[model samples]
Target: MDINLSLRHLRAFVAVADCGGYSAASRQVNLAQSALSRTIKEIEDELAVSLFDRTTRRVSLTAAGEQLLLNAREAIASFDGAFLRFQHYREGLSGTVSLAALSSVASILLPPVIFEFQSLRPNVRVSLEDGFAGEVVDSVMQGRVDFGITSLPRKKGRLICEKIAADTLTCICSSRHRFASKRSIEWRDIEGEDFVSFALSSSIFEVVEQGLRSADVSLGNITKARDIGTVAGLVSSDLGISVVPSLVLPMMQFCEYRGMPLSNPVVERNIYLIYDPETPMPPASTFLMDLLRRGPRSKFKIPNGVRWIDYPDGSCQANSN
Candidate 1:
């Protein structure tokens, strides 16, 4: 048996097994049907064992195929990692990392990270996508993006999520807002105010709604939009006041502001970088993650304070001023 079987052959085999048949696997792996079948045959010939027991209606993994699945996954991961390491060593720094983040973080935190990331490693390319925090998490879990930076740690399981920052949540109003002059407002203070919310689809909105409900507050005249930036824009135009993470508060100068910590129930969102443990990351993503681990604390290009607090349970608090 020849050990000269290429990764493509193993990939073809796995695709067929995963997709239920060669025809489907060909589409999944983006190989032509004939090419896919040929590669699988080559792999079977190399190993001198029937990998898949194929029938007209379905494809099933035989003993050899079942045995190969685990090794094939590991082999693929190793190959990808090797390419990444090679790229890292060759250009001293290379790879294009794809990152998706919450709209707020994209506006405030991402600039310096991108700037520092690119300046430190000139060869690496970075693409940034912004969307709902949940969408960002979904992107990371689905392997559509290498990493996701989001403001809420609402869900657990599927992917590994770590707290990168304890982002403060704030209530923002436009300059013309009637309550802009108030020193501080309670949870019930703005309940009846026209509101531009962080979309009904956002789990952040749900978290906020829970808090509001706990305090017996109800939102009014809610306008739903997809991202925080849109919510902020509408707020700035006097469309309605909205609740947003405190990190973005510094960016809304045209909007009137008071940074009162929500009390009777303080609201803080722990932001995280999410990545899939089961899926493999490319070289660019691996290096970028490494740099994140070693670099100085990330700084935002705004005047916001993110002072740290020690949570009662010994976890860090959202105060990084």
Candidate 2:
């Protein structure tokens, strides 16, 4: 049998059954006695059973009504509980936020922020995916993640990119290298030096290449490495020096290397928060994005060579140097 009934119908039935008479039930449910009688009649007719034995002064439930009462109460309670949980999710009290970021960012910049976010919304789970800049962008575009953090320059019009921070490129070399004695090294200082270049596919490679080209300097490319650890290993072995964003220095700390600030038309790699403006994020995701947009420098101690960008009125502006 097709049981086409609404919650209102069940509520009316329950109210009538609980109150024991139409006059009282009508008062409790805020309906006229006539309307309450009609609602009870509709339920009885649909089920093809006498749900209540009508008396002059009171009504008593039949066996079928007794059975339905149990099930109806359970169904309503279940629905109410589910709705309460949904409300919590909507309020950002509980839900999952998935995010992607560059490996350097995931390791260095995000830990303290994630810790603070979890403290505020303990029930909200944060899932972080670490990858290259291109992978981070792809995750946001494909809806694989709620948002992404990357140093890759904005190339996609579909994405709404906001610059969150900038890290200066630094010349990384062995501690024993002559460049380490200097406070900072100009781009021309590394000209004709044996250089360990990042692989062509690396996002850092493109930035370094552009910066070098802009400064009118060239290096004798000795080797190409894809992994930061590999580059560190090569440089520590006195193979050659390489230029990377200052944020990358911490990862190479175990190796004996010094990061000297690179100048002569200083190149700053801009970090961006990227998301598809068309997609609606979950409450937890939106909350995390807001925390990030507030600028990490306000909440945590950032590295020396990195600067947070000011995001006011949805426009990108550099923070005071």
Candidate 3:
């Protein structure tokens, strides 16, 4: 037997069986009475069986029709269920999105965004990994994570990077440091001072190196750390003063440390959302990426005691007011 019946035929057959008449099922299926009757006839013709006993007053299902009714209802239900499942996935209400970011950005910046996203899409799962900027970029490039949040990479080949926010570099030191009480300090002032810096592979290290070179200053007795938490710990203990992104202050566990903006070609790093443009991002990940692109600090509530430094578009002014 060549089973050449379509879903429309099954739906009309089920409706006619349930409604017990062509006119009632026609209204239920939003089809004209004639069209509905023809659909039922097509299914019966294809199956080579009489499915309905019709008269001027009433209509009844035949034995063949009764047997098909069970299977027809099941088939229609399965089709509808499958369509709904796909719709949920397309709308980002369900599925998983994985992302990688610097530890500071993950701990301080992602909480509000993730919380809000979870509240709206409780069924959608979000997984996050934290590391240095280089590691984060590697994860996204290797397809380990869908996207990454970090400082813009030095190499931009085969990747799409979008700036999310302006983060100014700040001088972090214990209260005992002389410049600690100053609202702003110049790079020259810290040229001869002991400096705690990030690992050479980290993006922050590159930025610091370039800024110092531009100002004709060199780091003295440098202490390098692989993680920002360790850098914060060293600074809080008054081991040495370090330059770091102002946004990292909130995520660091240290207390009693002051943040002063760097002057004389003030160094500011723009945080970027990086992903591979070749592969399509998942619907849930795309939604989160859009949220991040809108400027996380502006779209979401910022923590207290931290002021937002608005960088005018197309300008690089990062001096603290």
Model 3: per-residue Cα lDDT over 242-271, one tens digit each: 988777778674567888878898877767
Residue 26 error for model 1, in Å?
Answer: 52
Q: Give each model a TM-score.
A: 0.60, 0.86, 0.84
Which model is ahead, 1 or 3, in terms of lDDT? Answer: 3
Give model 2 RMSD, 1 decimal: 4.0
Q: Rank the candidates by TM-score, best first.
A: 2, 3, 1
Model 2 per-residue lDDT tens digits across residues 260-297: 88998799888888888789889999888888888744
Q: What does each candidate score in C-alpha RMSD?
A: 16.3, 4.0, 4.8
Residue-level lDDT for 34 in candidate 3: 93
- In candidate 2, stretches whose alpha carbon ends up further than 4 angstroms from where it belongs are 18-28, 53-60, 313-321
Q: lDDT scores for all predictions?
A: 0.71, 0.86, 0.81
Question: Poorest 10 consecutive residues of model 2 by lDDT?
Answer: 312-321
Please write out the lDDT profile of model 1 over residues 189-236, one tens digit for every residue: 877888888767775687677668878987779898875557767887
Ten residues in sequence with the least summed lDDT for candidate 1: 312-321
Best by TM-score: 2
Q: Judge candidate 2 at residue 132 and give its lDDT.
A: 86
